[model samples]
Target: MRAYRYLDFITALFVVVLIVSNIASTKVVLLGPFTFDGGTILFPLAYIFGDVLTEVYGYKRSRRVIWTGFFLLILATLTFGIVNALPTPPDQQSTAQAFSAILGLVPRIVLASLVAYWVGEFVNSYVLAKLKIATQGRWLWTRTLGSTLIAQGLDTGLFLLIAFYGVWDNALLWTVFVSNYVFKVGVEALFTPLTYAVVGFLKRAEREDYYDRDTNFNPFAVR
Candidate 1:
């Protein structure tokens, strides 16, 4: 298969955002009246990148990037788990404890994130690919926003419920869910213009605006 200049860069960015967002999610942040995890700030960028990837590269390549991200996340979580389990030197015990405090909670968060991300991203890409064909590639905003609305909804709801349903209060759990969904979708809407610019540039530069009309949509198929 031929390689594109920007696909690797975008894939790397996607993975970095995914990892950083998962780590940041360890802290619950409050801004004025709204309360949410720290990840909420940066996580939406991953979805935006997801939209761009599907929009430019088509769903098959996007699937590869998504699975790459999935495995990388698992590797990161395992590495953290190992480091957290190691013995600390006497003087560094406090520092180790701090590290543990931050990353110790990552297992569950990572679990929720991985599951939600896998399902959500594929759905986003698949929907956008179909929308691209259905709309005959017009109305870019509809594909981006439409896919994000459904994808982020699944992501927010599944992540919150799986990670904190029993741990947090029922009302607070739902509150976080609602807030996350709103904020993520809002981010996508806010970035629509930027998305349009990026997608346009990529299509022009690569000379390819892929439509998965005859392509297989199976999430498990790598090719």
Candidate 2:
């Protein structure tokens, strides 16, 4: 963990925020004529952080943070559900409605997000870490873009299917899927220069570019 200074700690927090935000918004928001989901912007950034974590800090620790995010999201949802179901005073009708609107998560949608996120993030991290070793740490762009394509594909496909399969028409459903996939990977691609800049700065600033040469790829057990 000390190999990359405080990256693991920050990553744990980032992943938690990513999961919660992903659950909060699954609909597209219009930026003028351009359309994109609120989650799309931030979600891809999680991948960027995941890449930075795994690429320069090794895969094992990254896995621990990923698992931490998963557990925290689960714990949050359970706690929220419990609180929402508790008895409320009749005089607090307004407060109850507000609480339900904000804390409410359809069980199916929450399940979908969890399934997609767990798979997608791990895929992104594992692929980036492996590519770093296989390429001898060359072509940083290739791994970043390639892994997102695959990871976000799993993410978008599963999330859309599980969250909106029969709820929307085929056209809109496919549109959402394509829109999200394009936006997410597009964000990563567009941010390539920034990714490089951040990576370089962290490597030098932290004086570490860890290689997971002998890492255990287990998605459990913190290091």
Candidate 3:
């Protein structure tokens, strides 16, 4: 294994985004006519970082980061659950209730989020990797936008159905699904220029522009 100057930093940022997004997702926010979870504002950046990771470092290293994010999310969720379940001091019951209201983990939502993230991120990385080979690394925008479309669709659909299918009204469920998917893909498209910048800088800085021509696409394989 070789060390890259920014791999650890990028991975840390990616995991931090993942954990914070999950925490923020507890609130549904209304932005004018559109409604979305607070996480929607920043969660798309994870995919952008994913695109950069695969575009610069290749799928193998990106796989390691994705798995790192997955386990860290589990740890965060478990820690929150445990802390929320602990008894509060005499004068802190109100604070405890408020904390639980914001941080408590609903098992179904947590499961849905974890599964969706695992599947969506791996698919995103794999698609971009293969596209890099197919286009011979010609068009960066095509790969980024194309992969994000498919990945975000899977992620939003799976999460909404699993977490809120019968819990919310059918109409509201569809609204959230459409709103989240559109917003996420739109964010990726909007950030294409920035993605190009970061990818270019990382490639030049690390002297790496990896293509996954002979790489395995297994999601569970850590190596």
Candidate 3 per-residue lDDT, tens place, 1-223, comes to: 7899999999999999999999999999987667888999999999999999999999999999999999999999999999999999989999998999999879999999999999999999999999999999999999999999999999989988899898999999989988898899989999999999999999999999998988988887756
The C-alpha lDDT values of all candidates are: 0.89, 0.81, 0.94
Task: Specify the highest-TM-score model's number.
Answer: 3
lDDT of 2 by residue, 1-223 (tens): 3655668566765766686576556556865444555677678778888887777677876787788888888888888788889989999988988887777778887888899989999999888988898899999999899889999999889888898899878888887788888888988999999989988888888887878788887776555
Give lDDT tens digits, candidate 1, residues 1-223: 5679899999999999999998899899986666889999999999999989988888889989999999998898899899999898899988998999898765567778889999999999999999999999999999999999999999888898888888999999988888888888988999999999999999998877888888898889855
Assess every candidate by TM-score.
0.97, 0.89, 0.98
Lowest lDDT sum, 10 consecutive residues, model 1, at 104-113
Which clashing pairs does model 3 show? none
Best by lDDT: 3
Q: Higher-TM-score candidate among 1 and 3?
A: 3
lDDT of 2: 0.81
Ranking by lDDT: 3, 1, 2
